[model samples]
Target: MTDFPEIAAANPAFFVERVLSVHHWTDRLFSFTMTRPASFRFRSGEFVMIGLPSEPGGPRPVMRAYSIASPHFAEELEFFSIKVPDGPLTSRLQRIQPGDPILMGRKPTGTLVLDALTPGKRLFLFSTGTGLAPFLSVARDPDAYERYEKVVVVHGVRQVSELAYRDLWTREIFEDELVGEQARRQLVYYPTVTREPFERQGRIPDLMASGKMFADLGLPATGFDPAVDRAMMCGSMAMIKDVAKALEGYGLTEGSNADPGDYVLERAFVG
Candidate 1:
């Protein structure tokens, strides 16, 4: 018998995916991969609803929006989660193991996707905390590299330990046979920490304001040309606001699926 009755499997609108693996990054953070339903499809930077059954015999389940962390080409789906104590969904989500069932929403949608941004020479993906989840998908997608000459990633976290997927991004993805040439010449990684001491430490906005981030990347501090630099921001409401404000000074407009523009903004978390 299954650990829990697969109500989602019976429902045509949902897919009950089996857990493939889980990795713990810290007490408060973790990531897991699950089998992807053959019929399920989504863009690289979209968010989908996920959850465990409300109860063993309960028909309802508690679900929350989570960004799909893996690339669009991957056969399996992956997610980075914040392991909150007693959180309505994550409290139970953190314990999932191989063979466990997890419900996935049929439609994955979000504004952080590349479809919302206008064509440009450089693509800047800014994220913080669990917000890095969606960009993980974007960064790995070969389409992103083909669309722009350069892809700059800026991920901010509290400490060095919270930096997830550094090795994966630097080694595996960047050095992939298909995209290695462009990734080596175009992928610029700028990771920073706010509370802990590290080589680069500061709020992303602060670093951007001080020109240090651009200097480190060997790009001109004033080279944030609205005509060439297209950006996407995923993080807390405050972080998004701060970033949008900075980008607006350069005349970049916020974009949507309906109308592509110079920049795109989306909240990594709600409430």
Candidate 2:
């Protein structure tokens, strides 16, 4: 007998799977890996609806869309999440342990995908906080490396401790057999801390507007060029709006799955 008969009855689109592992990144952030159904399929940089069973005899399940953090080719699905003490989902989700049951929707979709952007020489992925999740999936895909000459990841966080996957980008990924060689020559990571002191500092828009980010990277000081630059922005609405406006000023156009353009944007899951 399943523990979530209500969920199953409420929607046949959802799959019930067991938690394979969980890692608490910080008091406010965590990530977990879950069993993936053989039939489940999704592209890198996409999101899927996931949730927990509703309280006994109350109502339907409480679900939220979360960006898939792991590459699509992986055997299991991985998700990075923010922990909100009062959030309906995270309050209980933060306590999940190995072997716990989780609900995952069958259909995964989003606009922050490679198919939505036109071909370019440089690919930039900008993210903040848990927004880094989707870009994680995007950065790891072999297709991304093959399509673009350079892959730059710009991660902004309030505190240095919030910078997750530091090892994966700085060291571990470079050691992997598949993409390591390409990553060594093409991957660039720029992590900025706003509230705390760090080697690099400031919000992403501020960094780009001042030409400091490009200067630091030894790239053109004039900033993003639509002709050779394809970009994706995922984070807070404020950051996306600001960055989008700035990109537009530099002649970049937003794109979608239906119409490939110079750039794309998506809102990070807010819990």
Candidate 3:
């Protein structure tokens, strides 16, 4: 791994880590793995601020809050990202390669962690596009299966190719030794596409409101039961508002790290 001793020494608020590998899933999306500092710690479903080091004699480095895609227990940290053609950070972030230096904040925090939700029979992770990042961490966590009887990951994207980490849910997680057994018995992957031909189609809110999601899962077609269901959501601003309203309509209250509730959303990660 490449080291950026200068950047680490220059900034006390963030750590300079080296990129271990990168996978470009599509022209618009990519995922990367990086060295995890022994000192850096965070719960699954949390997000941390990360950025690229500025050029010599340039302005301050650009930073953005990104959900940690790898589980909390993983030796290395992984992140899923979108390639924004002219985005302030993603424009440059998308071109990163293995051995490159990246900056990660010392502190990691978000409302999507399991601690923010009350005990329930099922946990529904709703996400769109790159918002699926944190759920990757949450579903891989063993505590999730223990706290809830089932862990449902519902990902909605524009194209089938944009369904990042599809294999992880479809097969890799089941093959994992630590959470595989639990995942096999309790995990459910419900992926849908908006502008493509797929087995499942429609926005998440529509599916939830129409009870299609429930029927497909073999659950009661009435809708989310606040007493038995817990949820976390991450997505575009429009998607967030829509889904939040839908959840609220079902009597599920929004939650945060301070107050546990029936549901939670990572507002900071919304585009």
Candidate 4:
């Protein structure tokens, strides 16, 4: 038998009840929204553990950390998830529907947030796969525009069908005449795909390596300064490491809750 934490003693206490609504973006990607408990509070970029009710005579519920996709002030909590065919949690999770019960952990925590970085003029949110979730929250927050002059969100996926949320979000933020005027001028959504032909192709690390990203943005490569720029990275472990090393070459340092710095990293999920 596996040892369970004392915190898990009362399963009902740790999990808040929620009604979920699902949206499938592709075979590998999907999103869901759940009713938020009145007392639930979290930072825009934090993640919380979520799971389904355990079956009778089965193993304890398997919970995975998911970044909050909804903005801080939103009444509902949203999550973007990858559907791994045989994943312990996702196998059953992918089948959930509206009005289905979902278990949400009490505490939410992560390093990808505006408060984790020192004030800067530009904010770069680098993501791949479901790693884009936290950035979705940050970008939708009007406060993000107030703190930075520019907000650039780069999302990389395996196919065009996987780029669902970017289009809707970009249009909503950039086309809204009132709430999105500043974001329209300062926000840039750059989408890239590895296995499909799109406006941008290749992984984010490669784009940074070849200087294509900078060239396309019409920004000079010579004056890369961490002082005026802050970045957040979330994706595969390999992708995060590669991107972090690349950012380091440009003088960016990793930051955490204990210290504020030029950049921060959060894993989209435990591998």
TM of each candidate vs. truth? 0.95, 0.96, 0.97, 0.92
Candidate 2 Cα outliers beyond 4 Å, as residue runs: 1-11, 269-271
- Compared with the true structure, all predictions reach lDDT values of 0.86, 0.90, 0.91, 0.84
Q: Write the per-residue lDDT of candidate 2 for residues 24-143, one digit (tens) a residue.
A: 989999999999899888889999999987655878788898999988898889999999999999999999998888988888999989999999999999999999999999999888
Arranged by lDDT with the best first, the candidates are: 3, 2, 1, 4
Question: Any residue pairs clashing in model 1, and if so which?
Answer: none
Which candidate has the top score in lDDT? Answer: 3
What lDDT tens digits, residue by residue, belong to model 3 across residues 1-271? Answer: 4447877877667898889999999999999999999999999999999999888688989999999999999999999998889989999999998889999999999899999999999999999999999999999999999999999999999999998888889999999999999999999999999999999999988888888988999998788899999999998887788889988988999888899999999764445
- Which residue ranges in model 1 land beyond 4 Å of their true spot? 1-5, 9-12
* CA shift of 202, model 4, Å: 1.1
Candidate 3 error regions (>4 Å): 1-3, 268-271
lDDT, model 1: 0.86
Query: By summed lDDT, which 10 consecutive residues of candidate 4 come out lowest?
Result: 1-10
Q: What range of 10 consecutive residues in model 1 has the weakest lDDT sum?
A: 3-12
**Which lDDT tens digits does candidate 4 get at residues 22-102?**
899888888999898888999999999999877656677898899999989988899999999999999988998877767
